[model samples]
Target: MSSPVILEDLQEAFPGWCIWRSSAGRLWATRNGRRLSQYEIDHGLCQTIDADDVAQLAEQLREQEAAERAL
Candidate 1:
C-alpha cells in the first residue's frame, strides 16, 4: 500500500536539522548551513538516511537501525 509522506516524520528524524521542499518538488535537508538531497547521501556518499527523504527514508532507517541493534 502506497501512502503519502508527512512533514512531521521529517521533523522527528532530523530534530537537529531542517527539511525543505523546493519549488520543483525536490526534498532537501539542511544542517549546519549545508543542504543536500536524500539520493546524494544514499548513493553518492554511501551515507545513511538523514532528513532529506523524511518519512520515505525514515522508515528504512528505523528498520535498519533495529536490525543492527539486534545483531
Candidate 2:
C-alpha cells in the first residue's frame, strides 16, 4: 500500500541503499555496496531486505544499520 511519495521518502532516507516496490507489491531494499562478508551474514546482515509495508521495511533497515555498526 505504499505511494510514490513514501517511496521517494524511503530513497531519500536510505541513500546508501536502493529501495523499491516490486510488481508483486512487496517492498524491497538492497544495499548499494559490495556483498556482505560471511561474518556479516553470520551476524545478521542481508543482501536484500524486504517487508510488507514501509514501517516494517524501515525497521529492517534500522536493524541492518545497527548490525553493520556492531563490532
Q: Number of clashing residue pairs in every model?
A: 0, 0
lDDT of 2 by residue, 1-71 (tens): 24334878888877889998999999999999788888899999999989999888888887898888994
| Candidate with best lDDT | 2
User: What global local distance difference test value does model 2 have?
Assistant: 0.85
> lDDT by residue for model 1 over 1-71, one digit each (tens)?
23336766655654644556767765655443545456545544323344445555556545544543554
- Candidate 1 lowest-lDDT run of ten: 43-52
Candidate 2 displacement at residue 25 in angstroms: 0.5
Ten consecutive residues with minimal summed lDDT in candidate 2?
1-10
Alpha-carbon runs more than 4 Å astray in model 2? 1-5
